[model samples]
Target: MRKALPVLLLSTALLAGCAVGPDYRAPALDLPEQWPEHVLLSAEARADWQQWWRQFEDPHLDALVARAVDDNLELRLQLARIQEARARLGLARAEQLPSVSAQAEAARERTPGAASPLGQSSTDNLFSLAGVLDYELDLWGRLAREREASEALLEQSLFAHDAVRLNVIADVVATYFDLRSAQRQLRITEATAASREETFRLEQLRFDVGESDELALRQAQSELESTLAQLPSQRERVRVLEGALGLLVGMTPAELMAELDYGDTDLEAIALPDGVPAVLPSELLARRPDIRSAEAGLIAANAGIGVAEASRLPRFNLGGLLGSAAGDAGDLFTSAAGTWGLSATVMGPLFDFGRSASRIETAEALAEQAEVQYRATVAQAFNEVRNALVTYEASGERVEAIRRQVTAFERTLELAEVRYREGFVGFIELLDAQRALLAAELALSEAMRDRLTATATLFKALGGGWQVEG
Candidate 1:
């Protein structure tokens, strides 16, 4: 036994030396060094992006984001998945260690008088106390590969949670902006309706005095009704957006409706950061959580190939039992009653209709699929960043253009009103000017909303914050 122990130790040391299967190497990406039209933002601006919602400088928005992070159901579900993965990792690690078990036994037997040569009955009792140790030698590194794959899966789950968090923050900010835009449009439409009503009344008075024709009065009434028609639809849209934002913060729609519908908060007061820092395309790929998750999945799959390969080779195990047994319970611990034994097992596949080879093939195919998926994830991340940048840049220009148009239309409305009152122009001309001004105002509001949303989307594409905890 002593000689066998030394040989066993030597074999264990040698078997522990190398794990079978391909080691993970991060795949190379063909990427550009810099983003197109990348803006060099100030360090202060870049820092603000770490918690991008804080850049808006709205206390309410900050509160909402905090609530969403804490209470959101989908995020909680991901956290639970991470816990499950962590538990699986623990199980995998445990497989590498030996298992020990305690055992106890008692037996009572009687010899019949007929079977006894002396014509006497005899009774005997037995007791035992023992322990068994069972351990796999891990000769082919199957356990090691399984542990490695489990670790990679845990990391993948963590990255997936982070990706979901990033999307949630972005969605909340964008949805809030949409709600504000809708509210502003609703206000603008209501005011236009009031102004049109006064214009209609004035035209009716003028017509009663024979100073205006029926056509003019009818045109004024039509404009007022059209402005009024927009209010209910706009208000309904605002309510729907509120319900959505409420759900994101883990509140029921009915519970959140009152708080959102009755607020007098001005959307214009929501201040956003200017000139987001430009990141290199290569750097962007490394920071994105979805891409990182995909890479981890590939690593897990690669380890899976090793595990499958190892399964085809011989398996080694060592088992032993140490115990004491005696007819009298008190003698169970005595040296005279002591017993011990050891065994070694070597197991390998003889033939299984190519099952082992088929497993290797399956593992290889999965690894290949994971690699392609990782590449596809990287490509998708790049495309999203490019599209966001383009939209942000274009949306800014659109806002500027709409601003100028608003100014021009406002001035034209004023001139038309004066000309109509002075009898220098017909009411049709004034009505046309009013419609143009209203459209421009609404367009300007929409453009501003788009600009803010585009910036949020870009921040999301850039992976927002990197301080995610696992």
Candidate 2:
């Protein structure tokens, strides 16, 4: 029996090296070699892309992004999930090793006088100390497959955390840009309101002195009131944007209620990035965390098929016990009181109405779902990059066009004012010129905001400067 046990163990060890089911291979994808011809790209170093928000050259924005990375609730939740996956991986690894336990016992019993050969009852004590060992032999590599799946899940968790982190950073930057835009709009409205009020006062004085008619005076007052009416809505927009920015920067409810004080930063002053990185479409698969996370999930599902397949085969377990037994506790360790045991167990599904086969089918179906999801994630990533590139380029062009429009309106307003004062044009013409200039200036402000926000979106779509480590 002893010789046969060693031979069986050696044979099982050899079989353990051969696993059941399919191995994992990365899915192949056909990707473009270059971006569309209309998309602008730059062959620039990506070192600065890691903290892409710093390109705006605003210290306050840099600080806010840093705070969001450290304190965002969503990021904290992902970190906790990572820890849980790590623990599960540890448990899976432990299953591949042996388990040991120690036990000690003491017992005393008295036999009835009638049951004993001697006519008197006697008390006896039994003392024992034992150590037991149990190990599952991976004859079909089931434990190894389980460990592989657990490792992939851990990778999935890590990449998922990175995905959330990328999103949080992007949101903070985009919200900051929006807040600045709203502030700029509010300032434009306020300045226009003040100018109109001055114009109204001058018209009132001219009407009283008979230089301007009541019609001109009433028109000036109406324009002034119209500008005044926009003040409240613009101010409210600024407040709402401020609240959004505060939340993105991870401010508590109390802190937001107290009003976040982002220093006076002008929207126009924010520098536009010169160009975006020129990376091939295939390279995007490596840079994006969401794509990597999806692939990890697929790999895990692939490994699960092996686990299910191995479950239909036999499982071999080896167990052993070494101990000492004696009538007295002091004599438990003596040579005459030694005890030992060895056992081998084989368990497999004999007949359960195809239960094992059903499990294998379920695993296969889940694997197919994961593969489809992976492909969808990759497709979505490419679509976003394409749209962001187009939007960013178009926004820049729009800003330039609006700037030229503002310049032309400013000149027209100046000419109208001069002609009206010289009695060559009516006050109605001057009013139209003033209204056009104000509208153009407001549009220019909004266009500038959109350009900056578009740049941020492009950066996010390109995976925000994250790279896979070697």
Identify the leading candidate in terms of lDDT. 2
lDDT per residue (tens digit) for residues 1-470 in model 2:
98999999999889889899799988888888888875444554555667778888988888888999999999999999999999999999999999999989899999889989988888999999999999999888789999999999999999999899989988888888888888888888889889989999999999999999999999999999999999898888888888887887778989989966888888878888887767778888888889999999999999999999999998899999999999998888899999999999999889979899999999999999999999999999999999998899899899999999999999999999999999999999999999998888888888888888888888888888743233
Q: How many pairs of residues collide in model 2?
A: 0
In order, candidate lDDTs are: 0.88, 0.89
In Å, residue 49's CA in model 2 sits off its true spot by: 2.3
Candidate 1 positional error at 222, Å = 1.0
Tell me each candidate's TM-score.
0.94, 0.95
Clashing pairs in 2: none
Off by over 4 Å in 2: 38-44, 109-123, 466-470
Worst 10 residues of 1 by lDDT: 39-48
